[model samples]
Target: MTEHDQQTDGPGQSFESVWDAIEDTPAEAANMRMRSELMIALKARIEARGWTQAEAARVMGVTQPRVSDLVRGKIALFGLDALVGMASAAGLHLEVRVSEAA
Candidate 1:
């Protein structure tokens, strides 16, 4: 298959969300998805500032190991509230948007 075809799912092969295609329950998948997004946002902020994990820890008020976990995408090791707190400490704004499922 060509690269274009490989990149695009055909017909019913497409998944609405990564969670929908995984083995997790709907709620667990939702939590995982949210954590993943938060991790990406936090990591992006850290990288955008050219900060090391130690610097991120200092800014986010967490230890270096914790910052390492966040940077490494250790979703299971973090909760939504904790990530939100870290994001807040990093001077990032959190916004929740709700819309009907497609």
Candidate 2:
């Protein structure tokens, strides 16, 4: 098959695909899921405010490419610190708390 065809194969294009992608570590995945949720919430906020990606970039004080990446759900492309900064730029604050087991 050509590279172009492989690119269109999507995640589940093969029968060997498994739904339990992160079953190896539920807790880790839960933490990672936060990034997805944040992106969605922020995207909704931007949409609610009637801002285009470019406009949102301006408000976030970032380049249009950065906003495009964020809105496109490129979580792995952004580091955790960068994500927190993005939240702040979107008018939302991030609060991280860690507690030891009782």
Candidate 3:
């Protein structure tokens, strides 16, 4: 593919991420990206501890089905607040950094 193709879905289109391509706005894309990152971290943490969904749910103070949704990456089913709370309950420390966009 050419540089243009790499930058766009078609002529005169551009996106920085898959979320950007699919989401209606830059803010939505950013939200999805952050949620995805958090979900991935949580899933990895659970796996690294060899925890089943039930075990993870207990540790995170959520239901086993909720843990299943998390591990399955059901991003639409979770909001940032919920994910952050779960992360906190799992003993994970989180920091947010912001800088001007390029």
Instruction: Give the winner by TM-score.
Output: 3
Deviating ranges (above 4 Å) for candidate 2? 1-27, 97-102
Q: What's model 2's overall lDDT?
A: 0.67
In candidate 3, what are the lDDT values of residues 2-97, reduced to their tens digit?
211334678898776777788888899889988998999999999999999999999999999999999988999999999999999998899999
Per-residue C-alpha lDDT of model 2 across residues 1-102, encoded as one tens digit per residue = 421122224565432112114335545554565666677777888889999988988887878898888888887776666667777988887776677632
RMSD of each: 4.4, 9.2, 3.8
Q: 1 in model 2: Cα distance from truth in Å?
A: 34
Question: Looking at candidate 2, what is the lDDT of residue 2?
Answer: 25
Location of the lowest summed lDDT over 10 successive residues in candidate 1: 1-10
lDDT of 1 by residue, 5-101 (tens): 3232467575546655563576786777778888999999999999999999999999999999989888889999999999999999899888876
- Model 2 misses residue 77 by how many Å? 1.0
lDDT for every model?
0.83, 0.67, 0.89
- Cα-based TM-score, every candidate: 0.79, 0.63, 0.88
